[model samples]
Target chain A: DAGVTQSPTHLIKTRGQHVTLRCSPISGHKSVSWYQQVLGQGPQFIFQYYEKEERGRGNFPDRFSARQFPNYSSELNVNALLLGDSALYLCASSAYGGSGNTIYFGEGSWLTVV
Target chain B: QKEVEQDPGPLSVPEGAIVSLNCTYSNSAFQYFMWYRQYSRKGPELLMYTYSSGNKEDGRFTAQVDKSSKYISLFIRDSQPSDSATYLCAQRLVGNEKLTFGTGTRLTIIP
Candidate 1:
């Protein structure tokens, strides 16, 4: 089965600019979550969407926002990018059942803000 | 303190050696624990997952959890150069569907 897919694989943005990363969950999976991983660090939660509703959010700022489409695809948008925003953004998806514990992740989109 | 704590090691070991990784957590409510392996520039791939307090073994990997001390471990036997990557420990309350992760340890199994 095709796993979670994310795009574009790499991106570059200037300070004060904006960027958008996208993800498509696995077939039959309805829940999608976003995470940010800095170099040499683990993935930190960003936002989660299930059934087109925001289910959870992380400690990120208002500059970050996300939405889930009807096809279970997701988009992560970050505004006013800072140098600290350089990182790999991950997308994960799982079924919305007790089996939500088994989440599958995508390769992630690497964003560099200068 | 963070819910999960792991040493950010660039640990080097020889091929065929046994390797041990550990994480300590502060949340007693965390009932499920997991170990993930990540190659350079890639997302984490789940390696082992266990719930509550017990042990689970698969192939060259063994995962142990002790909820009393809030400690968990992942043991890799007969390590290979293919195992050279970063390992992250994560924990979450069962049914909560959110995971808290550690800083990750980089392991290099020299050939």
Candidate 2:
């Protein structure tokens, strides 16, 4: 069974440009979450969706947004990209969202902003 | 202060050695503790997850939680070169919306 799958393993964009990263959750999973991991730092949570509904959001600015599809696929969009936006964008999926959250992560998309 | 604090070590140890990694958190309400291991370019894989204060052993890995001191640890017995990776500690209180992570520690086991 394929765990979580992400597309466009890497990306590059100029300042003020926009980028969209995609993810498909594991079969039968209903929760999807996104995280950003900067160089030399642990990942920071961005957004989480459960059953195609926004369950939680992180401290990221309005430039960052995400939504989950009916099939549990997800897309993370970042606009007005800055050089600091360069990092690994990770997509994670879980059976559900709760106090007992144990997620499975995909090999992240590497984004480099110029 | 960060809710969870971990030594960001590029710790190098020899094969067959026992390795110990630790993290400390300031939140006394955190009930779930976890350790994740990440390879160079891949995502993190959950190594251990324990609730409350106690120890859980799985094969060559052992996870310990000491809620009294707000500390947690992961031990790799008979470490191997394949064990080289970054280890991250995560904690979440019952009401927190997300997991709070500590800066990861890079571990390399040499032959």
- Please give each candidate's TM-score: 0.98, 0.96
| CAPRI quality level assigned to candidate 1 from its DockQ score | medium
Which residue pairs in candidate 2 have backbone atoms (N, alpha carbon, C) closer than 3 angstroms, thus clashing?
A: none
DockQ of all predictions against the true structure, Cα-based: 0.69, 0.65
Error of 1 at B69 (Å): 0.4
Distance from true location, Cα of A39 in model 2, Å: 0.9
User: Could you list the iRMS of every candidate?
Assistant: 1.6, 1.9
Q: Each prediction's Cα RMSD?
A: 0.9, 1.4
Off by over 4 Å in 1: none
Candidate 1 lDDT by residue in tens digits, B6-26 = 999989999999999999999
lDDT of 1: 0.93
**Any runs in candidate 2 off by more than 4 Å, and if so which?**
A97-101, B95-97
